[model samples]
Target: MADDRKVALDAALKKIEKNFGKGSIMKLGEKADQKISTIPSGSLALDVA
Candidate 1:
């Protein structure tokens, strides 16, 4: 099971890199960081009613 999951994950990453170009993960992380930085801290809220 673990091996299967690893294989699937690797395949997905390769696909992403192919579609998005090399260093895509690092690019995504940088974009995410920029977007997250814009959000006000402590703004997240969850309601369980």
Candidate 2:
């Protein structure tokens, strides 16, 4: 289950990098943190749901 999550996250990150252009590679936790930090708190509930 964890492996599947890692693979999915890698694929999603690759797609994001492709669209945004590459710089430094981030660990999964860092990426998640960055996303969560940037999103508005009100919309975070909608995102998780």
TM-score of each: 0.51, 0.47
lDDT of 2 by residue, 1-49 (tens): 9999999998988988898867446665654334334555688678686
Off by over 4 Å in 1: 26-49
Stretches of candidate 2 exceeding 4 Å from the true structure: 28-49
Candidate 2's C-alpha lDDT? 0.72
**Per-residue lDDT of model 1, residues 1-49, tens digit only:** 9999989988998999899977666534354434322444554553211
User: How far in Å is the alpha carbon of 37 misplaced in model 2?
Assistant: 28
lDDT of 1 at 33: 34
- Spell out the clash pairs found in candidate 2: none
Candidate 1, after superposition: displacement of residue 3 in Å? 0.2
Clashes of each: 0, 0
